[model samples]
Target: MAASGQRRPYPQLADSPSTASLLQSTETNHRSPEAAFAQGPRYSNTQSFTSSGSTSWNGSPTNQGVLDRRSYQTNSVSEKFSLPADPAVWGSNVSPDFQEPDDWIHNPDPKRDRKSDRGGSIVSYRGLTNLGCLVVLVVGLLALFAGYPIIHYFTTNQLSNLGGFNLGGINASGQVPEMIGNYGLIDADTPSSAHTYKSFADGSEWQLVFSDEFETPGRTFWPGDDPYWEAVDLHYWQTNDLEWYSPQAIVTKDGSLEITMSEKEINNLNYMSGALTTWNKFCFTGGMILVNVSLPGSSSVSGMWPAVWTMGNLGRMGYGASLDGLWPYVYDSCDVGTVANQTYNGGPAAALSGGDPSNGGALSYLEGQRLSRCTCPGESHPGPYHSDGTFVGRSAPEIDLFEAQVSGGVDSAGLSQSAQWAPMNHEYIWDNTTGNFDIADSSVTQLNSYAGGVYQQATSAVTKANPDCFDQNTGCYEVYGYEYQPGYKNQSGYISWVANGDVAWTLDAGGMVADPETEINDRPIPQEPMYIIANLAMSENFVTVDVANLVFPTTMRIDWVRVYQPKNAVNIGCDPKDYPTAAYIQQYADAYNNPNLTTWTGDTSAGGYGQTEPKNSFLGQC
Candidate 1:
């Protein structure tokens, strides 16, 4: 209460001394609140206490008012204050004697996680540890399951004779099936279908030079094994071919020569096939060549190409020696003196008559010569020099007797998977004036403008003409023949492609237009000795090949190959005797009264260019 009979403005201590006087006493003495107020009496709402005794605020005496030095007491000095022990009321004013319950934890073994130990096993946790174990188990299972196939793929011979479905009733081993018409085993005793050409064009009789019946079964020709024919072992990188030529792929079985093409990986190549070539052993100039063959797979078998062709002997098979001889050598003189697109030093008289303007009209007599004899740029002299001291460096002049492939562009669009069309033609280098060859771009720059025929697969004509010739899955064996006859000097010549006893295509030297620009009219036939090559290749040039659907272990079967020639026909080969002498060649030139038909000054035409003299082991007679 205030002296003016009004309540104090600030919150007053209910029954204690004034807050101002108490605070001042405590601050001055620096004593506890209880110590500073020790002389005063404490009071509650219903009771009060004095230093004399406990009393009521209304001046009434009460024994219930009890107190202790540290805390308020009820009945006895040991009794605590009668109030809830909530922290809100006690706050920071709690007596120093008060104590709280202990909540600190203790662990003797701190290294162990006791909670996890009591929970579950390690497998129960779904974590990276569990994931790693699962992954390892899966990988192990996959490896175990795939072990056999991986090992077999790497170790086994995929082209083996065993296993796989039948191809025309022949297994992967390429056994000769029953002769269906002329398709099966070639008979050694009988004359071939090409025997009809015995009476060659121009009233000449044919004589057999080389013939192979392949009668001995189980005979195999490995690389460098056979005297006449050797298997080619290489990847034909020049053609972007997908197969590696393997010697083991060529085999003679059941009286037939079988060339197998299969899905076999070697040297990073995805396929394996066979090629048999009579390279350095035997080569011939102008003659009649006949082959009886059954190509592997039809047009449906994409990327499959089977060919029997002749190449200039100077070019080694699979060796990239094309600069030496790749075919189509037009002018014998590859001198740099000649200008481009010009008529042999810009003189029509000189170009046509074998006289060079640069040579002061002197008759070198080597104008229309298409021999691979020039020392052109990058031309290597892989040679056997003649008696006249001129190396026989001839590689141009190619004759493709048979090349089985699908047609190109719209022609192929009209063909079915069963139809196989082959092109029989000759290729010449693009150099009409200079015989230089750009071997790097040979494919696009070559010329095939002469007598050529697309293979029309005369199965009906063939089967009708010869009852013995039967058509099978890839069609029956057909007789493919090429007859080339050298002319009288630079006069008219005769070359014909025969199919089933009929001339399918012919190049009449007389019918050709006399044009200086297009040298094809000059009748540039393959004059040099060309060796034979037969291969089953997977080429991407012709058709889009479905590699996934290609049947593995397919085969190309060859019944027989027989070569014939006329007696008067000048057939030059590797044999030194077959080589024409300068005087002998001049006889024909003089008869035609054509100076361009004559050979070069020192060129004897005795042997082909680049022929090895001491290494000439060719046993064939011209």
Candidate 2:
């Protein structure tokens, strides 16, 4: 009978072949756990009997099954066990027990090494380097684009402020009244020597010598009829027993004081005309001085002379030894004549036209000579006759006085000199409103003799004869149309004339002569401050004024005087010890030392040779 509660199934090989083999086998492997368990089964009476002997199955022992089963189970349960290859598996052909080659485990093949390498990639380093470079480049470009405009804006703004210092404190707001009082009218009648001229002590440590006295002997008065002659003259005015002669003879009245000249007076004072200096009086080493003068009433006259100029403090005149010496002389004259015939009596008389002589002399004379005509007349005395038949003249003819206010140190060559002309006449104008002069009906004359016109002969002659005179070596003579006349021939080294308000004449002693082509020496350079002196002249040779029947006390009034200084020297103030800078002196000294750098060749071709250098350049050269 079967077990009553539950019957357990007998453990058996399910496969028929295995069961038959097992039944037929005689010995059983006892090494297997399954065989052992099967053998331990209590007392037979279960589903099957346990085998105690070895059994065989189809040429192999069935016990191997138990061993195989137990081994497989053990392998399946092991943590470190690996799956055995099966014939059905795709890559199971590889031997499971075969050891890996050393090359495969540690030193991979060249091709495999290259393919598997994932370290030290150059791409990442290159990328990072490129990124850094790009960042730097971007930053640099940004700075360049944004920084320039900001710098320019600030630089220009600062430069503009610096430029204003040249005008000596901007606009002349409160300076007008003080200037007028300080540089106003001088009583010509009063003897400067007698009336103690008050020299102001402005802390500049400056002293005055001839404050109220005239260097020359003469009395200045005012004109009665015409305000143009606000200042007049007196003849034979003996001051301190010195016989003072009047040039113009008749005296007139104006705001200030002036003295007109007759041919006789001009000739007498010829020695004094060219250059005058105030070295002894003021001792001004460098700076500027301004003088105001009124034009003569009668423009219709030849040899009308008026001038204001300066010379070296050393006090010398003419050319040759005086000019070559350390102390030289310089002068400024207003006159007219051909460059070849620039002498008092050398050139052909200038002509006049347009107005009638009945009113005041020859209209042609007034226009051509007195009006400051620059060009030579063609054919006729007053020229070939313009549509208006008027003579040409230089509407503006005035002298500018420049001096060294302070001394700049000795140059590299150890010579004290002026680097520039403190007072330049560029764009200078006469104020007709407040003075005895009038420019209402006046016309400006082109002082440039080189301009194409009839003045070619004069211009060419002057240039050829003068050469590099008038500091020409330093290009100083280029400032004025006329060259320097270091050895001027004529008595009046520098002279200009106005004839009957129609004709004008400018004559230089050193200028070329017309017929014979004679050369005149140039006046010497000046080194001191000089005052302005403008006057009208009557001449027995060419002009005659009826002073007996004319109004007494005719006057010539000065409007104003203006002094200009170099832009660099402005606001330097008036300090005597360091009056002039080393740089300023060095500039002029260098120019003086180097002949090539300072020399200027005049234009001898055609009518274009009379052009002068600009005032600024002249200053720079000095």
Cα lDDT for residue 527, candidate 1: 48
For candidate 1, write residues 58-162 as lDDT tens digits.
244432222231233223222222333564442234665544434444323335567735766566557767888999999888887897679778999654211
**Runs with alpha carbons beyond 4 Å of true place in candidate 1:** 1-197, 322-326, 333-393, 407-475, 487-491, 510-515, 518-523, 570-572, 577-622
What overall lDDT goes with each candidate model?
0.47, 0.26
lDDT of 2 at 37: 20
TM-score of each: 0.46, 0.23
TM-score of 2: 0.23
Q: After superposition, how far is residue 592 of candidate 2 from its true place, in Å?
A: 27
| Candidate 2 lDDT over residue span 424-467, tens digit each | 11111111122211122123222322211111111110111112
